[model samples]
Target: PLLKIANDMVVDLPTPSNISAWWNFGSLLGLCLVAQILTGLFLAMHYTSDISTAFSSVLIFLHETGSNNPIGLNSNTDKISFHSYFSYKHLVGFAVLLTALTALALFSPNLLGDPDNFTPANPLVTPAHIKP
Candidate 1:
């Protein structure tokens, strides 16, 4: 039924000549969604979504580089700074994901829909529901 509606909608629309790369934005958005899902799954294997262990699990994965210190440096300081690097990388990935989503929406507004979701990340609190 949904496929029929989509086909009818496409038939009702006029096709554009010289379609831009923007036409491919849906695939890009799908790729981003897949990446997010896979990463979330991996994280979930070790993540305790409860309020107590969430932050600690993330810290363990991000901060555990190795035990070897080259110049007798303190492990704690190195881990702290390295964890910041991991955090920055995660933030950048999210930014790219958002950019891809925005581009898709701008080029193809009909493809977008909203579903109720938990609020964005909060280390101190647990979401009341988990979708999957």
Candidate 2:
């Protein structure tokens, strides 16, 4: 019953033709939200009470990296067509984001990191460029 309702609401609903690439952002943002949640979950699982170990674990996760939408209204009311259009846009956005991320991680891993972050941890003294 619920599935039927959802299908009626989303999968078969009609959206306007004016819905542009901008509409794609809702779905893409949703994708980002899910990605962030999963990342937080995994990081929390990997985290530890020990500061040094946690720092190191986070650094490792950073270096290695990790492998890891919306609504409308009526015109002609071709929901599937609009859904397909939005789906394609969503996928293109993901692909572009993924490609850029992969290129940066693979080509310039250190580009975004602070120089001090890669340095060896020293319990005796805090680095001058501490992130906090």
Candidate 3:
């Protein structure tokens, strides 16, 4: 299949050929950005960006992944058309995320808040070094 039916990215990868180094760089940069975006999306699926947890999560992610949180091994194989399948998936994903966040906030308003917002981060204490 041309796109593996939108399931797999095996065919989607840009194969290097007789292109110039500069052209290759453009492809490389695009690939990097796509990978970065996908990585970010996967993280956002699990992590929330609220006050109290944000600082800890940011520090932990930096320390553990060295701020390079990966999207893991290539595994989207069966392939569908990106225009039809992925575009819809993107919109649905965003909708689901927003719906979930709205529900959570409505049901548990205090869960997403930062208790220490007024205090601010202390320069003397490094959150990355603090014990949980």
lDDT of each: 0.60, 0.63, 0.62
Top TM-score: which candidate number? 2
Model 2 regions more than 4 Å off: 1-80, 118-132
> Compared with the true structure, what per-residue lDDT tens digits does model 2 show for residues 1-132?
533333333433345676433353357653454465566656866664466787888989755654221343344454445678899999999999999999999999999889988878879997688878
Q: After superposition, how far is residue 56 of candidate 2 from its true place, in Å?
A: 45
Off by over 4 Å in 3: 1-81, 115-132
Give the TM-score (vs. native) of candidate 3. 0.25
Please give, for residues 56-90, the per-residue lDDT of candidate 1 as tens digits: 77777657853456555665655435777889999
Q: Write the per-residue lDDT of candidate 3 for residues 4-120, one digit (tens) a residue.
A: 322234235555676544453367664564566566666776575555488998888777666322554334563333688888999999999999999998998878678776477
The per-prediction CA RMSD against the true structure, in angstroms, equals 25.8, 29.4, 25.3
Q: Report lDDT (Cα) of residue 50, candidate 3.
A: 56
lDDT of 3: 0.62
Error of 2 at 52 (Å): 43
- Comparing candidate 2 with candidate 3, which one achieves the higher lDDT? 2
